[model samples]
Target: MRLRNKPWAKDKLDQYPQYVISGPELLKGKWNGVFDKVQPIHIEIGTGRGRFVTEMAKANPEINYLGIEVQQSVIVTALDRLIEAELPNIKLLNVNAGDVTEFFEKGEVERIYLNFSDPWPKSRHAKRRLTYKTFLKQYEEILINQGEIHFKTDNQGLFEYSLKSFSEYGLLLQYVSLDLHNSNFEGNIMTEYEEKFSKKGHRIFRSEVKYR
Candidate 1:
C-alpha cells in the first residue's frame, strides 16, 4: 500500500497528547503509569489503521494496548480511530518497532501482536521481517518471562519462515493454525488487512510463540 504523506498528521496527533506519548522522558520505564493502572501492557507493531489493537483494547479492557507504526500517515489513521473510540486503555506510537526497548523497560510488556506484518519475501531481506531472530531477541528484552508473540499473516512463505525463525530462537510454539478463520481458535480479532485478504479467499495463518 502506498502511503500518502499527511503534512498535518503530526499536528492532528499533537491534539491527542493523552493518547500519544511524545517526549522520551515520559516513556522510558514509565509506561505503566501512563495508563494510571498497572495492567498488562500489550503492544502491536505495524498497527496499520489500528483496527486490531483498537478492537483488542475494547475487548480486553483490563489489558493496556500500545500501537507502534513507523509511518506517520498510517499512524494518523489509527490515532484518529482511537480518539473516536474514546478508549482510555490504548495509546499510539509513531516510531519504529525496532526501537521498542528504548521506550519500554525490561519485562515491561506482557504480549506482542504482529498482525499481517510485511512479508519481506525476498530472502536477502529476511532480517527486515518482524519475525526474524534479531527482532525476536529484541522482544525478549522487554517481554516478561513466557510473554508471547501472537502472529497472523496471509503469506504462506512468511508464515513458514517465521515458524523456523521462532524455533531457531528457542521459542515454544503453540496454537498453530494453517487456516485461522476455519479453525476453532477463539477470540480471534480481524485486522483491516486480514479482512481484505480473507474476503478474497485467502487463507490466514496464525500462531503463538513464547520465549523458552
Candidate 2:
C-alpha cells in the first residue's frame, strides 16, 4: 500500500522525543539506559501501526520493545498509538531496517520480530526480503547467542523461502505453524496486516528460529 504523505508527521515525531527516539545511532550499545529500567530488549523490525509492539509491551512489562519503521508517515500513526498507550517499556525508531546493525551492538538485542513483512516475490528482488541471508547475518550480529527470531506472514512463498534461508544459515527451527490462527499456538499478537489477511480467510504462517 502506498502511504499518503503526512506533512505534519515529522513535527509530531520530533515533539515526542521520549517515545520517538532521535539519533538512535548514538545510543548504539547504551540502549538499556533509555528505558526507566534495565531489561532485555526485543525489537520489531517493521512495526507497522504499533498495534503489536504496544500490546506486547503491555503484556510483557519486564522486557523493553523497540519498534523500527522507516516511513515517517506510517511510523507517525504508530507514534500516535504509542502516545495513547503511554507505556514506558516501548520506544519507536524511524529508521531503515537495512541499517539496523549500525544502531545496535553485538548481543545487544535478545529477540527480533518480523511480522507480516513485504514478500518481495520476484526472483531478482529476493535479497530485499527481510529473511534473506544478508538480513539474517545482520540479525545474527546484533542478537545474543541463541537469540530467537519470531516471524509471521500471510504469504506462503515468503514463509517457505524464509524457512529455506534459515536452514541454510544453520538456524535451529523451534516451531512452525502452517495455519497459525487455527493452530494451538497461544499468546499470538496480530499485526494490522495479519488481522486483515486472517479476516479474509488467509492462512497465516509463523515460525521461531534460533541462532547457533
TM-scores for all candidates: the values are 0.97, 0.99
lDDT for 70 in candidate 2 is 94
Candidate 2 ranges with C-alpha deviation above 4 Å: none
The most accurate candidate by TM-score is: 2
C-alpha positional error of residue 198 in candidate 2 after TM-score superposition, expressed in Å? 0.5
Work out how many backbone clashes candidate 2 has. 0
Give me the candidate number with maximum lDDT: 2
Give the TM-score comparing model 2 with the true structure, all chains together: 0.99
Report lDDT (CA) for all predictions.
0.90, 0.95
Q: Between which residue pairs do clashes occur in model 2?
A: none
Candidate 2 lDDT by residue in tens digits, 127-185? 99999999999999999999999999999999999999999999999999999999999
lDDT at position 186, candidate 1 = 88
Scored by lDDT, model 2 comes in at 0.95
